[model samples]
Target: MKRAEQVTFGGGGLDRAAHLRGDRGALATAWADPAAAVLLVWQGKPLSTRSGRGSSPDQLVMIRPDHPLAASHRENCIFLGLAPTGAPQFACDISSWQPDALDQAMLASFADASEQQHPDLPTGQVFTELRRMMAFLTPLEAELAATANAVLSWHKSHQFCACCGQPSQVAQAGWQRNCAACNTSHFPRTDPVVIMLITHGDQVLLGRSPGWPVGMYSLLAGFVEPGETLEAAVRREVLEEAGVKVGAVTYLSSQPWPFPMSLMFGCAGIALGRELTIDHSEIEDALWISRADMMTVFAGDHPGIRPTRKGSIAHFLLQNWLADTLD
Candidate 1:
């Protein structure tokens, strides 16, 4: 657990500059700085530029506010924070532009392609999905992309105040929404999810959601409901989904899963009994796999089952567990 934050999207030591968020003048000065940079996003994807040579490196595509593309879309710009170097950083959503015929054709090549180009910028700049490019990005880049996507997604869904059903306007450096009619203020939300590594002796439990890709399984997981503790959520979820009682849950690590904002609480729990009466409504299948077979799954040598996705907290825990290094 010592290297827990080393997980993808977990270790961006960003200076959020939260104290300056409420200062309109400070926010203005940050963005106006010549060194300020913005990460462009379209839909949920962040813009990235790659060297044409396959051996070369890929990087996040950043531009100044004065850049043509950054200037093109000002309505949805968000102040992310100051970079490690103390330069201002921001995210701009350009989801509204339409691509040309050539760009449209280029977009078909990747699952989430960056076919649309600013007339002033080079051709390789494309908005690509974070999942596909996560491994290629640095910790800071991943954090910026995740934060932008999560906060922007929240704004898109929470245009109206929940308290009084009145329209809300962006405030506090894009961190809050204020409603004039109801005097209600709302902040960005991050749901807590408990992803448990349940063990009984040398075996671990894995489950497949109803519509997951064939052969794909991960640690059993669920949201922490209102008024529930993280430990309680783990026990309740395991019991509810697989009908397997758990005891002595221990915190492992955490990951920021920004598919619309979730903080995955990784934990290990002891299984009191082995019987599994799977709740079909919660999961498609659940089973216990021995440690030896888990080794094969991680190596991609298993006969039928695919391991959990790399860079995930479940994969992180299982890898350390295999190495006897889960400290």
Candidate 2:
């Protein structure tokens, strides 16, 4: 838990400048500040100024946004301003148009050629003209990238009014949608997921889903359905997948996984049974592993069990669990 924030997309304490959003004079002042910079996001990757194939070394990203309109431009990208901390600045992903393409000249600092030229960068029909360059941006950059993807995805999926079957208009500076016909208001949504570590004594549970890379194994996770509590969701998912009963579920930590927006609730729970009647429909295979074997997986020495993906909560939790430091 000490390095919880070190996890990929953990967080950077940006000011978010929320106080200025509603006020014209104040918002204009912050927007005009030279130190107040915008974090640039293209596709889902942060636009890093640093030179690296991956991993932005610092979280400070600065791009000043110029809306040039009296009122907010609906569906325009959001530029969260951050006041400088001792080190880099902080940022919050506030506004953006519905899921847009990753193309052409974006409005941030110049990105390297590797990002502008990558094959994955061509999906954007709108800003696809931005050059491709490869570099590792800091957390601020990652946050902005997540912002673009989440907002755009929301907009793409939510064009119609939920109440009146009429098309809606962007409002609230890209954070809200309004039905012109029915006067209904809509907001961006984030889904919830529970990623659990089921342990008996020395061993823990692991499973693999269909079509995943060979030997890749991690904690069992699933969404929290409406009307279900986090604890209930965990028990349900565990039973449904590996046929193991759970007891004494407790909250541990949370991470923002913005692959289309999800909150991963890391948890530790006790497995009541060792027998794994895997529902082949839910998991390819499920079983218990001793701590000794877990060490092998972490070391990449396991013949069949693969380690958790880097930057994932599963990896974070498993690393701590093995070290006896989940406390």
Candidate 3:
């Protein structure tokens, strides 16, 4: 756990200027600064410069504040923070813009492989799925994109006040919503999820959902319910999904999983027994794989299983476990 923050979307040293969130004058001044830049999000995807066929890395496309698109959406801009060089960073949602020949079906699929291009933007810069490009982005880019997507998704889903059931207005530089009717303030929410790496002897437990691709499996995970601790969540989730009792749970690392806003808490647990009576409703299959077989899976030599996605906490934990570096 010493390298806990080394996980993707956790170690980035982004200077989130929280002091300026409620300062309208300071925000306006920062917005007018020449060093100010904006990132545009369309349908939950951030605009990025596509990576080349070989060596290039995909980067977030930083648009000038004065750009036509950014300017038009200025009223709804969220102040993300300041860059390392003191430049102001902001994000705007342009989900209203429709593209030509748009395939609605692909956009709603499990994995959206399509890229969207705006007519006014430069060529090669498209709004791509974050999941598809997360592993290839720089640490800072990953952090910024995750923050923007989470905050924007929150605003879209929580437009009304929970207290008075009245429409709320953006406040605190997009970090909060205020309702005039009840004078109530609501902040962006981040749900906590516990993903466990349960082991017995030299074997680890993994499960695949019903619709997962063939040969794909990952550590069992579930949401942390109200009044439940992280340790309790891990034990309960493993037992519920795979009928495996877990004990001695310990925290490992965490990742900001912004697939609609979640913080994944990666933890290690010891399994009391190797027997797996998978709950068919919770998972399609569950099994215990030894360390040797897991190595083959990581190396693409295993015929029955594929490696977990890169940039995910599951892969990070499993890799560290394989190298005896989980401590």
User: Which candidate number has the best TM-score?
Assistant: 3
Comparison by TM-score, 2 against 3, better one: 3
What local lDDT score does residue 275 receive in model 3, on the 0 to 100 scale?
86
lDDT of 1 by residue, 1-327 (tens): 788888888888778989988888887788789989999887677888852237655578988898877876655578889989999998887767666554654443323434456556678876666766776678998889889989988988999999989899988878999999989999999999999999999999999986576899999999999999999999999999999999999998898888878999999999999899999999999999999999999999998899887667788888888887778
The clash number for model 3 is 1
**Model 2: ten consecutive residues of lowest lDDT:** 125-134
Those runs of model 1 whose alpha carbons end farther than 4 Å from true positions after fitting are 50-58, 100-121
> How displaced is residue 189 in candidate 1, in Å?
0.7
Kindly list the per-residue Cα lDDT of model 2 for residues 1-327, writing each as its tens digit.
455665555574555555544455655565555555544444444434433335533232343344222123322544343534512222233224334453444434233233333232223212221113211334645554555556656776899998998999865445678898989999888899999989999989998888676777889999999999999999999999999999999887887776667888888899997998899998898878999999998999899888876667898889889999887
Specify the highest-lDDT model's number. 3
Residue 137 local lDDT, model 2: 36
Ranked by lDDT, top first? 3, 1, 2
Whole-structure CA lDDT of model 2:
0.65
